[model samples]
Target: MSEVTVTVRGEHETRVAPERATIRLSVRAEGSERSPVVEHAMRLTEPVRDSITARKESGVIVDWTSTRLSVRAERPWNNEGKRLAPIYYASIDLTATFIDASDLSIWVSDVSPWDGVEVGSVSWHLTPETNARLEREVASEAVGVAVARARAYATALGLHDVEPVEIADAGLIAPTASAPPAGMAKFRGMVQESGDMTGASMAYEPDAIVITATVEARFVAR
Candidate 1:
């Protein structure tokens, strides 16, 4: 007698609003000398950091880092077609991660006034607990779908017993956040109304994070 085997695949997807957010801010400064450019970039970090700390909402975390720093002179042609004195350029980046979305508006309003500092992306995501819970639920649903398909296959083959021989997690899909607003002008205006952060009610809303789970199951019939 020969044994019969069936392989089935199941997929499940779930969407949920994000519960956490990461906001990045950048500072760029340029000058004729390396010292001045670097100094200016470093000086710009104070106000932005101070502003976030001043927020009424608690649990707001701020992290500052230097993404890029370069001090090189670039020669340019003058009206006479002669190379002019070299110009030096320097740039720095700072990022802030906030647990509460409520502080986004105020942070933007306060930091927009700075000359070189600009608001970066605002990524939203579900917390670890919520993500884990969703993963488990979706995994179960996917396996159920696979089991049903396997049983149907066994019945069609005139098999009495159908047992799952192999099962595997196909790796869950990660969630993606919506792109940040186009510019700070509109975002600043949205929060300037009452000088209050637009907690979860900003004019722009992040897209719901989608999570997908898949499972592959192999069944054998006796």
Candidate 2:
């Protein structure tokens, strides 16, 4: 009878600075009627557009847009009671990109609206250059970790050599954030705050994103 043998697993990690970032901006407005609400909401586009343009000129902003627009009616608590006031709302969103770290920081500070506007959230991303560099570093780290573990296993088994039979390189895992999932509330808020051209504050915070990768290797006992 022939005996079977197996090798243990190994792992390692490497950290690198991120290069690229993606910013998501959302604007909302509301009113009693769709037309009025849309009108007010549309006005927000100007300021938002200006903000993006300014950032772009400074070389901090990459892209901006009023991608979403929604309109809805305000419902009263009591169905039987006469509607006290009809409400309409609309929302606008913008996205800005920056390459330099200092520029990115400045952009975040500048983009924050003190009034009449809401900052949904902000996120950081790894640029292609950073991503590629990290991939190589991580792969090397992983291989080093694997070899270390393999050496330990071989020593325990009193083996002189171990051969790598197969290596599975599972590329990097891009980072992502979870959206509100529903746009109804977002739209409603925009419409409700339509009249307040000054701006409104929203309860949202930027999230940190982490990119990762993994690999699997098959080794043979020699």
Candidate 3:
């Protein structure tokens, strides 16, 4: 009989194969003598850096970075309760980004067994352009969901058309404090893993990226 305010939340999610992968690894050297640790570390790290540079030139690697050498000394007690001489450890951390997941797997397999090389986890993601496009589309779909639900509620109440009053990201509409503007998509979720993109020689495959969007809206229904 009269206009009523309707508030609802909308959500949408989509899964897509990852378009990029970043490999993290470190080159480490430890020796009882302190003077030679840094040299050994540098020597061990050079090949890895060269490989990444070559890949970058050839367009296989999108980007790469290596940290300065880190050196530390530690002394430990022996089994007989006697303290052993100080041991010096040096390490360099490097990360390389690849546009192809198969190439990442190949690079990881090639470097993982090298002396002083420790391969870390791989991060899977979509390019910024791709993510932005998907996020906008997903946000639009979420708005549509909100509209459809509002209409359903009005129809159930023997009402006619519904008009939107306000819309904001999740929590902004009802929260007390001023919340930061959440992106159209909050996070890129890694939901599924498949080896189809990588060949048999590859060490492993990357997980799929999930784009999710949520929104809250208020409407007037009659």
Candidate 4:
């Protein structure tokens, strides 16, 4: 049998400032009929579009797009000749990109009318510039960590010198967002609030995203 070889592993984490923001907004409309539900959904989504446009005009929002549109109908279930009400609902989802910190915060705070509208999720991002800077910082830190670990291992093994032979980056980590599925009733409530231009109590708190990277290194012992 061949001699066994031992490989060590090292990990490091760094918290870098986020340079961009992605805000996900879901607009919904509901009514007794499909046509009216769709109409109301469109009407309610107008303000959300307007809000995004306003932010763009004010140089706060960088980009915006409608990601998804869905319509759902729920028929009343009858048992023992009991009658129930039928429901119809529609929903629209949008994503707005913010490049400025102040604007991002303002948009998050001001994107109200949330009673019916469900704030799906929010994600922080690293802009190209910030990403480049962080890459360099993290790489340096990772190398230091690897070297320290190798040194410790070499000392424990009674080795005098340790030299790196290979270094390969595993990959970079990115932030992602996931929203819970919504039903017709929930969609309709959001649309109604927006269409009626009524204000409701809605509070949202987005989680912070932490990005990480890993590396596989091979070193020779002397």
Candidate 5:
């Protein structure tokens, strides 16, 4: 048989447990007076900040940050449609990364009931080194799949040899290659959170991270 072109797409996916959890929290206070609100937010934030710094030193927390205190004022309307005096709000946002998920749960449970502390969300992700390693492995496997597919096509055509002509990401080998496919290799992190009101307790749930890689290849069969 004469040389013929064969194009195929290969994909690989793997799921892994997350290695890090980053949580966001805000300390907020509101009142008819601006000064007291600001002071109150700052006071509530001190213990939270202390806990994060202590955890960082103990290696339970990898990193943490705090935003400057901010204040906003708004005049709310009552049922009578009368504009009331402006109410002042003060807030500060804080974020912390925990290497251990259990530590995150413990810390959140401790701070959640504070007068002005609010838990926002938790992000679960893999370490950079692990993600890179797994992505490379899956990409190589995808290439192998492309080769096997080309060989199968050659066999069906009564040919015995297949050789790779070109290889690119999921979109690069075809006329439609300009737009990369969504299945292409990417770094992804999952944001998940849950809570239970049982006895005023708290809970956290983080899903597994999934990595997928796709590639396109062109081969000659004869």
Candidate 6:
């Protein structure tokens, strides 16, 4: 009899509370010339940057990185609907890491109200060491899931035994959008406003971060 093979996929998921918080902010300026816009953006961001720098002294801003500056010219479609005299725009983006979970609200409140500044959603994440450990654990569990399914298939087909012939791995799947925990909805929603807001009434609950692993195994009937 010819050999037969079946491919089965297994998935494993785990939830963990994030250990730290992250916030991204953008500083932008527009003008008729590149130099003027670049200067304006830098000046506008000074106050916000100063606040974070001050926090860094006390460990609130654990880590931060600045992205390269970008400048582009406005597309011209005549004066009626678009560009009048070729406006230029310059902007800088920065991301900050806050290790103290309790300081999330304070950090957001400090940065969101600056002029010409835009705030991104506050996201929570695990440390590098923690993430590595979780990944290993889930991967092993997923393989076990695959093995069980293969054995069940072998029994139904009346095959003597089943053995894995080929195994393919799938990488981790992360959430596309941040999911705010219950009671923190207002805190997250406050990001849309350009003014300082308070969320003292709400309690912070680290949203459970979901990690998923999938594996495909080809099993041969013996």
User: TM-score: which candidate is best?
Assistant: 5
Error of 3 at 91 (Å): 0.3
User: In candidate 6, which residue ranges exceed 4 Å CA deviation?
Assistant: 1-7, 31-37, 73-83, 86-88, 154-163, 170-206, 219-222
Over 4 Å off, model 4: 1-6, 78-86, 100-105, 108-111, 114-116, 152-159, 168-209
Number of clashes in model 1? 0
lDDT of 3 by residue, 56-113 (tens): 9999999899999999999999999998999999999999989987787788767777
Q: Give lDDT tens digits, candidate 4, residues 1-222.
A: 122122444445566555566777788888788898888888778877898999889878888899556998887768767656778879998988877656655555555544346565556666667666656665666667767777787777777577777655532112123221111010110111122323433333333334444454567766
Error of 2 at 73 (Å): 2.4
- Candidate 6: lDDT of 81? 77
Best-fitting candidate, scored by lDDT? 5
Candidate 3 — what's its lDDT? Answer: 0.82
Residue-by-residue lDDT tens digits, candidate 1, 120-143: 667666666886687777778778
Would you estimate the TM-scores of all the predictions? 0.71, 0.68, 0.88, 0.67, 0.89, 0.66
Model 1 stretches astray by more than 4 angstroms: 1-3, 55-57, 62-72, 79-81, 157-160, 169-202
Instruction: Estimate the overall C-alpha local distance difference test score of candidate 4.
Output: 0.60
Write model 5 residue lDDT over 1-222, tens digit each, in one string. Answer: 588999987777778888989899888999999999889999999999999999999999998999999899999999999999999999999999998888887888788877788888888877788877887887888788878888998899998888888888877666563444433456566776545322355556667777777888999888
CA-lDDT, candidates in order: 0.63, 0.54, 0.82, 0.60, 0.82, 0.69
Better of 1 and 4 by TM-score: 1
> Residue 124 error for model 5, in Å?
0.5
List of clashing residue pairs for candidate 6? none
* Residue 39 in candidate 5, Cα distance off native in Å: 1.1
Judge candidate 6 against the unseen true structure and give its global Cα lDDT, from 0 to 1: 0.69
Q: What shift in Å separates residue 32 of candidate 6 from its native position after superposition?
A: 5.0
Hey, what RMSD does candidate 1 come out at?
A: 9.1
What's the CA RMSD of model 6 in angstroms?
Answer: 8.1
